[model samples]
Target: MRKILATHPLHPRATAMLAGAGRLAVASALDPKTLTTEARDADIVIVRAPLPPELFQGAANLRAAIRHGAGLDMIPVEAATAAGVLVANVPAVNARSVAEHVMFAALALLRRFRVMDRDLRAKGWLAGREHANSTSELAGKTIGIVGLGAVGQAVGHIAAHGFDLNVVATTRSLRPAPERVGFLSIDALVEQSDVIVLCCPLTAETRGLISRERIARMKPGALLINVSRGPVVDDEALIEALREGRIGGAALDVFSVQPLPPNHPYFGFDNVIVTPHMAGITEESMMRMGVGAAGEALLVLAGKLPVNLRNPEVIEHYRRRFPAGD
Candidate 1:
């Protein structure tokens, strides 16, 4: 059987499909040494952890690196293309789950639930009840989205139609947005929005999209929510804003670093809601992503390109390598 490797343990649904097609192997750890060794014999890799460029050099048999989720940042696209490996991702499959997570965090932050619960546990009902009057509601607020991808658009749909909130979005695409969502420049959206949500990808241009100065431009006491990649917002800048109380609060589902380090400053801030990059993870979404990724893997195995192929240029080299197939 063709060898299939995964960076992490696969959901049972995905495991079943992969095993039926190939001899499945999952990495015990994500270190470079382990991955490099494991990838050397792999014909296909299902990626969850970041794949290094050097690993591609050793993966002589690797025909494809399939992403379990929407983002492709984990895989080095240029190196994969150079190595004749097809890169694929399942987009929009988890949009609803991520959008729902954004809404959940936004509501929790606006209502000051973190602080209230902390005080309620520490100083009893009186202390907690005191925070009751300082909360805000979601209705009638304008939500500005940094990106207009599947997750961003899903968030807009819910915020506009379900919550009765005005939605404004920024997108490089010239296509007009839905009637309910007004397309605006990032600067204009920052100034007018009551809630700012980041759902953009992590690119060089977007690495520090929400810089210190960008946060300064927000309406005073406006809330910020990040359901996108962590580096999209400047962590240091965000922390300072929360410390100074310049902004109302923030809900961050992703971060520049994983595990976030024990006793991080974010842990001490009641105004900041820190999640371990789980905005796209839900039981339902997991199944969808697993099935989507497995289906794509199967297609590539059968000498067919993925329907959601991220790097099409790799196909020319791929066809040369798999001459007998495609």
Candidate 2:
């Protein structure tokens, strides 16, 4: 049986599928040190956790990698492609879950729900009704989406139809998103939006895309929501913006660092809502990703190309190394 190594433990349902696959192995935990040992001779590495390029060096038999979800930021995609290893990710499976979380955060921040909840719990009533001026409705507000990927499109759809909010988006795609949604220049969208939502992926060009200078251009009291990777926004700049009230509030599901240190300034801010990178983490989403990843792994192991093969050029290199006749 071909050996399949899972870098981290998956959902219990995926565990069940592994048993059925009959050739699966899982590390006891998600630490990279453990993976280096567990995956040394494995034919495939299924990764959900961040790992450095060094880990790939130890895998002599690794023919392919399957990312449990979208986003290849954690997997060193370029290195894997150079090494002739097929890398695959399941995109769009988590779009609805992530879009829902974005809406949840946007509503919470827009309405000042967390602050009011804290006050009510402490004083038995709203300590100050006067703060209503700061709390606002979601309707009629313009929401600017930074990237028009699956998650961005999903968010735009909901924002437009469900809330009747004006939707504007910026992306590399020249293709517009239906007639009602307007495509704006990034600068124009950031300045005009009442709420700016980031649903983009992190890439070399996109790192620190939302810089301090851009933050300064936002409408005063504009809400910021990021469901994308952390490095897309400069964290120190974000703290400064929040501290000075350049922006009214932010809801972030991803951060520059995971398990944000207790002393992180974002934790102390009254206007920020921070979650532990769970924008795409839902029970339903997890199951779909698990099944999709497993399917990709199976196809790669059979010497056939998997759907969503991120670096398709890897196939040409693989064929050269292994030779089609062999």
Instruction: After superposing candidate 2 on the true structure, give the runs of residues whose Cα lies further than 4 Å from its correct spot.
Output: 128-133, 320-326
Q: Give the clash count for each candidate.
A: 0, 0
lDDT per model vs. reference: 0.90, 0.84
lDDT of 2 at 87: 89
Expressed as tens digits, the lDDT of each residue in 287-318 for candidate 2 is 99998888887777666788998899788887
Top of the candidates by lDDT: 1
Q: At residue 146, what lDDT does model 2 achieve?
A: 94
- Candidate 1, residue 21: the lDDT equals 89
Clashing pairs in 2: none
Alpha-carbon lDDT of model 1: 0.90
| Position 133, candidate 2: lDDT | 73
Model 1 lDDT tens row, 167-226? 999987887788699999998998899999999998888999998888889998899999
